[model samples]
Target: MFSERFIQYIKYEKRYSAHTVTAYQSDLDQFMLFLNNPGNADPAPEPEITHPSQISYHHIRNWMVELIDQKMLARSVNRKMATLRKYFKFLLQEGVIETNPASRIQSQKIPKSLPVVVEGDRLTEMLDSDEIFSADFEGRRDKLIIEMLFGTGMRLAELLGVKEQDVNLHDGVVKVLGKRNKERIIPVNTELKNLLKEYIDLKKNQNFDNNSFTLIVTNKGAGAYPAMIYLIVQKYLSNISTQSKRSPHVLRHTFATTLLNKGADLNSIKELLGHANLSATQIYTHNSVERLKSIYKLAHPKA
Candidate 1:
């Protein structure tokens, strides 16, 4: 019964990131697949059969070791561990289980890595790259999508989740579902608001039953999926980004970095990013400090 609904509860109720929910789904899928494996046991069961929830710590440790042998990165392993922990925690809270075996399972320590953000001119170029933004409906939609992500520092899911009613065009604000299903209204600058209005006008001429729900949609009028969002971000920015990962999250990072460099308070940035804690927002401060250190080194006339 653990379907996308449970995932949504984690997203809305627990305030987990879209990325976190996807990872949890993947890890739980893998664990379920492992449990359903009958080759290692007596009298193989049919495919898609459910298994009991009596997993041992040794089994989890073995799974971690297997992931290591498969050359999964430490960050990935740690994420899987976190997923298991969350799943068990949910099970316990729901009274589905008396104890969470994953409670003692320690996540692999991952080194803190600063998020990569596209630099000034590159960011401008990425935003201005109109080769993909033709004088067509789809092109205009893509451009608006990119602008919203880079402008708002919003997660792609939040952008895709935007409803027509949620936007206050008069006030130049857009309300987005932030982490834990919390609502945060972000101010849309004049330029961004103008572009969004244009996109909405174009969308008005399209056929869509769900237009009442989602602000953005595919050419087929379906709400944008997370993968589609990633592809759109990658299709536009990979050419301009110096870093290897040029997904929507990079645009989010760029948004945070730009704000911090311009003197936005950490708490404000946290609210904008919908982060549950200031610690999550502190990463961008590190990026700003590193850039400041570089600028100081380059400008100081120390002998």
Candidate 2:
């Protein structure tokens, strides 16, 4: 009952994305299960914790220890801890608990790693090569998917949420529903605008029962899902780049890095990528710095 209310609060009041709400609910459920069965590792029999008030710092610590024992990454464990901290903070605010048990717990320090980005030259080669993409509907859709992600720097979820009406061909702009359901307009190039018009015309000719009004759809005319989008990107990226990480997010990182390398300001990139804060966009600067260092090493005779 308490969990349900908490879910509702985060969904409606906090306006969290469905994906985020589902993750929070999963974390809470796992914690509850842990409380009920502290596990067979303890030799001494202990009472099962039946209520949130009964939870203590020791219980939370033991859970973290178990997570570590399972070889889960520190970043993932910290996310779970964050979920607990938020839940307990909510409980304390509602007067259900006198204090937050997760208050004293500290998150694990995570090492910063630069995101992988596809080179601009390679992307240009693949997109421009007629042999890479077929003339069929599937080919057109796949090409558009790559162009959209690299061109707009939109998240996979945002791309999936795009609708036919969200695209303005004449204005050469596409409306993207970003994180927290915030909408942003991204300009499309002439080539992409023409592609969009062609794709829409082809889609209309097929006339499948696509009542959802989603812009991207499967061969069956159903809305595209995350896994489907991932596979589509992975298959095409494998043909050109040898990056270990070839997901849609890599394309987003590629978009930001390309812009930064070409002299686009961080603030402008942040707004284009729909980042709520500049910090999230600053990661791309590291890639830009690395590229500059490479160029300097190759060109400067003094070095």
Candidate 3:
């Protein structure tokens, strides 16, 4: 009952994305399940502790320990911790609890990793190669998916949320509904503009469904999913990039890095990338500096 109200609160009042709300709900449900029956774990309380007031720092800590024992990554475990923090915070706000138990817990330390990017020139060459993409609807879509992701630097979720009306080819801007249901507009280059027009015309010509009103669609004209987008990115990028991650996000990082390398400011990039803060966009500067080091190592005349 408390969790349902929390779910509704986050879903509506907080305006969190459906995916985020679902994840939060799942976290609460799992925590509740653990509380009710913790298996043979030592954390199990004397009774089936289902009430929110019964929750203590001990149960939360034990849950984190159990999650670690199950091989959950620090980042994922921290996300689960965030869920608990929010849940208890909500409960505390509603007077269901006097104090938030999760407030005492600290987030797990996460390792910092640089974002990977494809070389701008290599990416351009690959995109320009007609031999790589066939002339069919699927081929056009595959190419467009790569182009859209790299061109706009939009997240996969933002790309999937893109509707036909949201893409304004004439205006040279694509509107995306970003995280937390926040909306942002990203400028598109002439090449991307033309590609959008072509894709829209082709979609109309092929007599496919509206694809749930999304710009990117599957072969059957259904809206694209994360796995489908992942496979498409993997198929094309496997040849060009040897980096461990060849996902669609590589294109996003490539977009940000490419802009930074070409002298775009962090603030501008932040706005263009729909980053909530400049800090999130500042990582591209690191990627840019790394590229410069790579170039210096290759071309410098040092002993």
Candidate 4:
């Protein structure tokens, strides 16, 4: 039977991201609802067929074709295919199925799109430190958030997962819970340390008593949600350039690109970003190279 138990399995047992779990649920729920065949345990009208697990590769292919015919974007179609593939893989792993039908299904060929990142000067302009810190609590929190993002280049999820005790005020370091629940410690600079202290002082006056260990809190004193973080980043960075998509990820990309532009090694950047592999972090190098080509086009001679 379709249940929340599967979602709990993915979240607690497999340590999947909330976003990932939501997508998996959507994919599986879609299939389960459509599975009105006789053998299915779901209490739905029969589909005039038996053995729902007998859903074949053709079924998945048809689903893809249907979405495409419905005018879905290529990227959306690809993501849906990926979700179905993951669901089938999960079923295979759990011994509920003999083979993964979705595995044979090919994802649509999406063009190689470059990452949208803030330029180095704009990044510097935003994190100028003096301009960030103000007498207000919101100002202080904003300053700390920007500094942590630009400094460590941590993912938005990792940043939001930061705990109060994880930060070593004296040492000026933060312990981040990265992808796959991997823990990494990144040092914060003096400016960030001071700003964080001020923010904490402001937070204490609010008398928050939530059990969540998150560092950033909402105006209502609850821990920050993923969407709230994205909105905050978008509110600040929307004016810079419409060409560059603004999100917490852009701040992360800006962090890595700045480091690469300043000659930081790729491997080190990978470690800092908590990427599973160097290849994941290598996109920043492409951004850096593009920047170099732009400058060279304008500044170089003998053309």
Give the top-scoring candidate (TM-score): 2
The sequence of per-residue lDDT tens digits that candidate 1 reaches over residues 140-215 is: 8888888899888889878988988888899999999876577998998887898888888888887577665588
Higher-lDDT candidate among 2 and 3?
2
TM-score of 4: 0.86
Name the lDDT of candidate 4. 0.76
lDDT of all predictions: 0.80, 0.89, 0.88, 0.76
lDDT ranking of the models: 2, 3, 1, 4
The candidate maximizing lDDT is 2
Superpose all Cα atoms of candidate 1 onto the true structure and report the RMSD in Å to 1 decimal: 4.1
Clashing pairs in 3: none
Where does model 3 exceed 4 Å of error? 43-45, 209-211
RMSD of 3: 1.6
lDDT of 3 by residue, 134-217 (tens): 877888889999999999899998998999999877789999999999899999988888878888888877777554577888
Clashes in candidate 4: how many?
0
Full-model lDDT, candidate 1: 0.80
TM-score of each: 0.83, 0.96, 0.95, 0.86
* Segments in model 2 whose C-alpha atoms lie over 4 Å from true places: 38-41
